[model samples]
Target: GFPGNYTDHTIANAAALLGAGRVVGVHRKAELPNYKVFDEKRYFHPGSRPTVVTVKGFRVGVLICEDIWVPEPVRSARAAGAELLVVINASPYECGKQREREAIARARVTDVGLPMAYVNTVSGQDELVFDGNSFAMDATGEVCMRAPPFVEGLYRVDFVRERGRVVPRSGPVAAELSDEASVYGALVLGVRDYVTKHGFPGVVMGLSGGIDSALTLAIAVDALGPERVHAVMMPSRYTSQMSLDDAADEARQLGVKYSVLSIEDVHRDPRDAGRGVRGAPGGYHGREHPVALPDAAADGLVQQDRTDAADHRQQERDGGRLATLYGDMAGGFAPIKDCSKLLVYRLAAYRNGLGAVIPQRVIDRAPSAELRADQKDSDALPPYEVLDPILAAFIEEDLSVEEIAARGFDRATVGRVLDLVKRNEYKRRQAPPGVRVSRRAFGRDWRYPITNGYRRESR
Candidate 1:
């Protein structure tokens, strides 16, 4: 199949290399999904017929990823005398997608009254992370065998003919992971595969004394080891002593190569230059000035640096007047680019639970960019406790200002946040790719145009 004529086909091959009549079964996916990072309908032609083959005197039905999502294909296979169903998938990871997959598989199994064996691909590709939680379910909708998430291995499930039906024998079932654990695992796997597959020897990143950078450093070290990760603290005149101390402590605790390169010499004080610049007020010169130092440091080491920007901040300031075009927004990859500020703290806490790598003060202190005097995140935007939920409602749930206000938020604040998200489209267009753990991310999932005229009026 070519680009526009692709088919998700499953082929059976014989063990012997020179075996005659090797190809026994072939099945093409009947359903083509076109939602949330999936665009199969744009490239694949939907298959219509069911393909069933015999194996060890039991009739086996073959299906692709989306086939079992609907009832037509599974019902057709059952009508065609299939006693067992085998599904091959490349399902990507979302916070609760494993349970969703099992629920859908159980529906198909119940409809056909046939046991199912599901196999999903594992690895990270670009912004997508495929968690390999392959599983098997009996006809009664009980999971018989399960594979752990974020791992690659082969497991066996025995099946026996019982009273004219193929019953899958119960096997080991790995327990489901908590939301934080699952998301952290996805981020770790995503960073590891992205760096290794792209053939980069290692990664370098800025280490601010903030939760976002601390979490990013921990993720980088976990993914590529401390030897391969380089953490640099580029402090400015406004950088606090607490920030410097915390940054150094993080690197020392993680056992990574650390450096502190002061940008104060090259960075002219806005007040000293007498440029008529007032006090630094969350503007580009104040906030993004230090961003360039870390980027430049990565160039010296011949490694790409990761940015610590999260989705909430990016949406609020990136394309607006506050963000410098290439200063803070510049980086090769952003591990938490899709995460909100609230989620960033959650992940940091989760990582520290394993073994306290990130300093407790880093997580406990107020969030700040440390780029300007007495700077704090709340100085620019709404409090994260209030802002993250509004962003999630608008960006992920596509709710209008009124709908969000109905959820007990101030209408004016909701309107303001939504406006910033819409206004920052141009800046987000230039952001680096990051692991997507939500139902929608900035890059491929959210596709609002850069030049749009539509605006929601606040009532």
Candidate 2:
């Protein structure tokens, strides 16, 4: 466990306090994964052997997270006379990830014909949110026990020897969560842990009267109570009266401390020459003036727009001109940065179902930044219905322009979207961290170089 040039080893072991602490047995992880947010091979040396330890006259096999993904480790353990298997994990949460985990566990158990116990950690670590849906399976690949997702608690599973074979007894099994519930739960847990673990007293975010910010505010209050959340509405000349009403209504319904700090005066003042108070290109002064207050005054400032990865793709396509650096993108954490615009609406509707915190008008209103007069998202980019699918094909599925266009999309649109994604790596590099709820996210999931000359043709 030295912190020098040698290397680090990840292991699972059983310990006994014989006078002091005695290491009875150890199982070093044999698989070093290096794909999609995992870079264990960069820092770890893989062990080549399987480990089984005896406890209370029962022989148990020990495995780490990645060790269960492959078959060699489990096969070796069975050959070594292991009666049961226990695998410890810290698997990150993604949509339908629990089903995938159980399927994999079932495959391994059926292969070895032995019961297994799987334990996963629960907590938010940076962008990764680990859902602790730990489980125990019988020899026939049936789940005997399952802990609830997004909850932290100790669970029990009992195994008894029957017909000279170890089998897990039937126990309570938690039901699976729907896609929206699971993603929303991940966002709430991610925000709560990021704030509390970093010792922030509270969170302050801009309330723009848009669905994204409304969803973020609801999540903030749910994570840290209404008392710890502060919502500020900084309206500009271009901001609509409907937006003002919706923002105030959202704050009032949530019972959070709210304020209205208009930036029209600051935008018009001529004496403030040295404070970088100049209008940006396109005559949009909205983004610059409003972010200054929360950036300096709040304990933690969260950017709501960056929650939609599809929006980020469009922002990149605008040559990073739409959102000001350190202005709209300034924040400590972005709860839904991995979500798409379509997913944002789905989550908004989902949150509203569980008590109706966000106003109905907010959900029904057309999406906009309201920076310029009469601005709509479709004015700058394709409709989210069209854009999100293209972005997903390129970012998550790694499909080519031709492949995406073959799916009844405009070839030119697919090409343009892919080009924008390629061009905007620098902007995404500077955006704040957020919960990862997809198979691929912006931060560690997508790692395109800033200066690259690769291009794919739509034709």
RMSD per model, one decimal: 4.0, 4.8
TM-score of model 1 (CA atoms): 0.90
User: How many clashes in each candidate?
Assistant: 0, 0
lDDT of 2 by residue, 124-216 (tens): 999999999999999889999999999999888989999999999888999999999999999899988988887777787778888878888
Stretches off by above 4 angstroms in model 1 are 1-21, 269-287, 303-324, 454-459
Among all windows of ten consecutive residues in candidate 1, which has the lowest summed lDDT?
Answer: 10-19
Residue 60 in candidate 1, Cα distance off native in Å: 0.9
lDDT of 1 by residue, 1-459 (tens): 112233335332111111135656667677888988988777666667788888777788888888889899999999998999988888899899999999999999998799999999899998899999999999999999999999999899988899988999999999999999998899999989988888777877777777778898898889889988877777788889998999999999999988888878756653345344455435554456666554554456543343222221333344233344455566677777777777888888999999998889888898777667877777777888788888888878988888999999988888877777777788888878889888877888898887856665544
Candidate 1: C-alpha lDDT: 0.78
TM-score of each: 0.90, 0.88
Question: TM-score: which candidate is best?
Answer: 1
